[model samples]
Target: MENFIIYMAKASGLIAVFYLAYHILLKKETFFNSNRWFLLAGLFTAAALPLLVYTKTIWVDPVPMAETATRTVTLEQLIAYKQYQQQMAEKAAIEAAAISINWFDVIVGMYLTGVLLFSIRFVLDFLSIRRILSGNIVMKDGRFRLIDSEKARSPFSFFNYIVYNSAQLKQEELAGIIIHEKVHSSQKHSIDMMIGQLFCIVFWFNPLVWMYKRSISQNLEFIADAGAIQVMEDKQAYQKTLLKITVQPDCINLTNNFYQSLIKKRIVMLNKQQSKKLNSWKYAAVLPLLAVFMLLFQVETVAQEKQPAIELIKLPEAKVKFAVQIDKNTQDSELEESKQLLKDEYNADVKYENVTRNPEKEITAIKVTVKDKGQSQVYEVAGHQPIAPFTIEIEKNNSGRNVITFGNSIGKDNFVRAQAFRIDANGDLQDLANDSMHVQKHKIIIGSYGMDGDKMPLRSSVPLKVPEGHWSVNSLKIGDTDMLIVINGVKQKKGDAIKLPLGQEIAELNMVKAKEAKKKYG
Candidate 1:
């Protein structure tokens, strides 16, 4: 809470200063009519930052299941996992690859910029006030200093510690205005106005807000006059003084005045009958909104911390062998979509890339990289996507790139489904697929597991979230591993290689049997 308050204060202060500078540069005036808005926006934005971060936070699952068809091969059939080993290496990669807005620049960069800009504005205002005070105009050597402004002919602010044109009035007038300006400074009204002006910066388009802001300034004057009544003993003399000062049509709206119409409002307010106040029972009105906000943002404390689910199954000690062809250009601004499984299942991570599109310049035909790995390996970021026939056999084809995924696969229990965890600024993830099997990036292919959610098998889950052109596939190969997965969209991997499984099928018969047994026996 403290940290968010500080940031909010910084944001408010920045906006206040920015508008202050803008007015000074162009209009030579400062307005303070943005009170509630600045306070509300600051509080709201600060509170929401943590929530946004939580939505993007990465989660990983490690699922292990026995490989049924994979047969163990040593120095004899080991030729492949070993033979192809020299061809691939790993480098830095993004799971939710940040195309342009990396984590650092958004969080840290924007914060620094906000703070520095506010500091500069503060210094400039300080220097400008000192210069104005030195001008020695109407109240030479007196505390009150006047500023030339087109917006308010007589509007003045007490924050700068200068009284604008107080010397021009008579002794009685000066006394009243002095009391008003002093009240403004001592009561901390300057800060209120400053904060209000900050709100105005954000809602400059709201005309009602602008009028309300001006009204608030005038009302503050009335309130101050009421306070002055507490000090002055003679009502007639004070009223006379207010009348004299009110004659000057050129009045400063910002600075408290000895003879402002506040005197009339004050008299009226003092004379008016007081309305009965509402009882505390009125508080019930906000119960629904408060309940909603709490549900959306309140963090819950877990009473019993359930251990994280970790499922492991030993392969019959064999590596999978299968083939899958993916279309290039179907994944951009890739995001993770989580699905729940019921029986023993292994997750196959399929990350796509279009690095060939260029980091500094835009181009056609993005390169996608796919790395495949299952939950069986720990401490090793091992994975593979089906390599193009040429890239795998031809020594000259070694020039292509391969995306590195987190150990390749997370984990699973039943079927796989897509929930669309992210979308690019352009709406959907950018598609670069060129293969015939791949969709056109705006359409998504969906298949059902049965009629019910709980009935979805470990092999036949559907695509819950689809972009254009993503279809369904059941069984396929990730590099040398023959794995079954759902297809979302087939995207290109490093250099023109295509690798992405969105709507695919899961064909783990052993796992299916386990689920079937559990259902029948339990």
Candidate 2:
């Protein structure tokens, strides 16, 4: 919910910035088409800005444990590590306890309730407009539909349908009305209004959104007036028509009414001089503003840097691949499971070897080898631990290639698959199976990656119920190179990532956090 709120706030801020630019720099200009596009592109960009992800990478000194035994731990380093451990422990304790009603939940409840009510209103408004046009509409000149309504003193249009009281109008007034509504229809002004209507439904409480709707409507009117007056032999006659109908009540919200309140501005814009073509450069200013928004609102993932401090071997045009060999004495079930997981998840090739015929003899260390290399990388993992996964990142920044192999193994006896739960704003919890959309709809932030494939691990801020001492949730952070989320207890060897949005109404979530979780849940 917090993340969603921040996104909405940034979205509104961006829209407001664009609208200010339009109002200040482009509003008075006679470039109607350009202004229309500017407004539309600005609104869409603002909405999309929050969904874009950006990354940053920080390189620090290497650790000694992964390289050699001569490394001594510093006091400051130990203190920082202890503090992180304590913080994780404290977080786990708070989340694992039974939740109570809180103010944040109440606020979310109110906001969703408002969304529901406004959504219903939006749908009904559409139906009302449809019902009105369905009746009393006549096909006119085979170009548009005309609705003759006795009570409709002001002319209005929705798409190609025009409604007005023809009986109460003079031929000049009728002509002006048809010409005005034609501009609205031919230009598809109602499409802009529909977009506004949707924003109002989804972000009912956002004042800037309402302001944006008004801006779009006002811009559309400017366009329609500018186009309509061109067809008039007597421009004053059209201005008079606008004045005459300005007092009438507006039609349904979906329709572009001829009698909008901006009569003076419409007349002024109708006579405004054409703007200089070079002034279009003002739109360029929007780029930096959007960049700022991206930096502020992009979701990030933070990973504990746990790569063994081994010197990297740079192989130009050489692809370094990993192969794992399991001892032949391993149980068929465990070995096959590992093989299938490797094949299905990582697409890695696996081989089996037997040194002894005894089934009870424990398999000591799994040997990992870089293809074409003489010495194999010995990974010391217990029979109960899943083999660690590694990635080879080729850096473009003149830095040598890095081969990162995780030191911790995922314990099979303690292995837990990702679990999801449906939580509402009121702190209610129900078990769900990998529903991303549901989690998102409730304003929960799911961790995601930029250069993602179909089989990436799923992470969510929403906590899940897991046994003590296992990874809980996943989040993403941006880096110059693709980094992996390496934790102590659980190993990610295959398609263990969440790909799609969970499709349910989940308010809050719980994820498994391995080390700290062990103390509480265990």
Candidate 1: residue 375 lDDT (0-100): 23
Candidate 2 Cα outliers beyond 4 Å, as residue runs: 66-99, 151-153, 299-522
lDDT of 2 by residue, 1-522 (tens): 888777787777877888888878777787888888898888888788777886666553222110110111222223344467689999999988958877778978998998999888888887877666665758685678888876465688988888888887889988988988899999899998988888777778878778878888888998888888889898999889888756647567777988898788898888888788988788787778776766765746444554423333211121212222244344555555554434442344344443223345555444433211232233334344333342211111224332323232211111112333333343333443334333222322232211221223322122333222212232211122111232323333332432211111222222323343354335
Model 2 deviation from native, Cα RMSD in Å: 22.8
Worst ten in a row by lDDT for model 2: 64-73
TM-score of 2: 0.53
For residues 357-406, write the lDDT of model 1, one tens digit per residue.
33433333323233234222112111233222111000011333222222
C-alpha TM-scores of all predictions: 0.38, 0.53
TM-score of 1: 0.38
Error of 2 at 2 (Å): 3.2
- Provide the clashing-pair count of each candidate structure: 58, 30
Please list the Cα RMSD from the true structure of every candidate, rounded to 1 decimal place. Answer: 19.6, 22.8
